[model samples]
Target: MLEKVIRSPLILIVSLFLMTIMLWSVYYGAFSNVFESVLLFVLIIALSTFLFLILFHNKRNPERKISWKSWTPYELKEEDEGQQWVTYRATRKVYIFFYFAIPAGLMVVAVFRHIEFMPLVVLFVLGTTQYGIYWHESRKYLNDREEV
Candidate 1:
């Protein structure tokens, strides 16, 4: 179970976010001035990410094996390997969090923490780039090619 979650890209990304939050908390001292609502929101994001992966993990990515070497987005291209429809759907669902949900959460944190909004703006841009990259790669997965 642990290994599978660790292996999934979605899980890893969310984990990175959670780690960033933890580091911030540690640096700023335990949500000392931040509202509980903000903390609750962060927890919800983490839990939802984990649950989403748990539900979809086994269902997507079938016999087609994309080598571990190409798992990193920067190293990958628009080669269709895994199940098309399923992978596309999963990619969209996950990006909703990356492109919208996480930034909203960050904005909420910024509001409560009295931090500058620029960082969340930067996060939004990063999320947009991630979505663009994902969309480019996943488009190939959206169609089925008749074997020649």
Candidate 2:
């Protein structure tokens, strides 16, 4: 379970969501003393553990250092030409997604101009969507390979 949690992108997504919530609460002055404090504590611990796990993994597997070096939403274990190709395809899709998503997000923000935190919400959505697209594409390719 710990290894799976370390490898999964879900932790990154959750952390980002938590961070967005914290930022929103701070900006709007809606932070409850108890709830927000506990949230902040959990967020800190999760991120710290994630970082530690990543570093430990790198130490245990020196060959995977390259994979850890360029961590991003679309990052994958590019162990071979085939994996690299999959990553390329996934990233291209993400780029295309952003091409449309950015404009749509901006329009939504403009429409909801009265909301002071609309930009942050848009950013959060876009960020999560990018990772979701990458994760989906990576899984699809992996599954296809496994079937073959």
Candidate 3:
């Protein structure tokens, strides 16, 4: 279970979000005070360790080759044509979502221009919505296959 969670795209998404938050805090001088500085140091160490573990695990996996020179996003293995089709469909749906979502998001940001974190809010919403669309489309395909 732990390994599955660690290998999932969910982990990558979450780690990226956390890193963004950390950077935002740093940029805003949220850790300017001594105690907060120490806390920030600890968080940096922890996140570094977590990322190291992920790298180590990826290194040990023979099937998933990762290198600094050629980085690839970790995705579910598409061993057959059917799996590839599912991925293609999911990607298409995500593209379609962005086609509509971008304009809507811009309008939302314009309306909420006074909110300090409105950009981040819109980013979070867009990210989650994209993932939701991909997951739902892929799951629907898998379910149809299973039902047959």
Which has the greatest TM-score? Answer: 2
Per-residue lDDT tens digits for candidate 2, residues 77-125, read 5779988988999899999999999999999999999999999899999
For residues 7-110, write the lDDT of model 1, one tens digit per residue: 44455456556655555665556566464457657778877765566446434654433334334542233345555454566566666757676667666676
- Sum up the clashes in candidate 3: 0
lDDT for model 3, please. Answer: 0.71
Cα RMSD, each candidate: 9.9, 2.7, 3.4
TM-scores, one per candidate: 0.33, 0.83, 0.71
Work out how many backbone clashes candidate 1 has.
0
Candidate 3 residue-wise lDDT, 1-148, digit = tens: 4345555556556755665565556655545567556666776886677667667767787565444345454344587899999989999999999999999999999999997566776787788777778877888998899999
Q: What lDDT score goes with residue 134 in model 2?
A: 90
Instruction: Kindly give the stretch of ten consecutive residues in candidate 3 with the minimal lDDT sum.
Output: 66-75
Sort by TM-score, top down from the best: 2, 3, 1
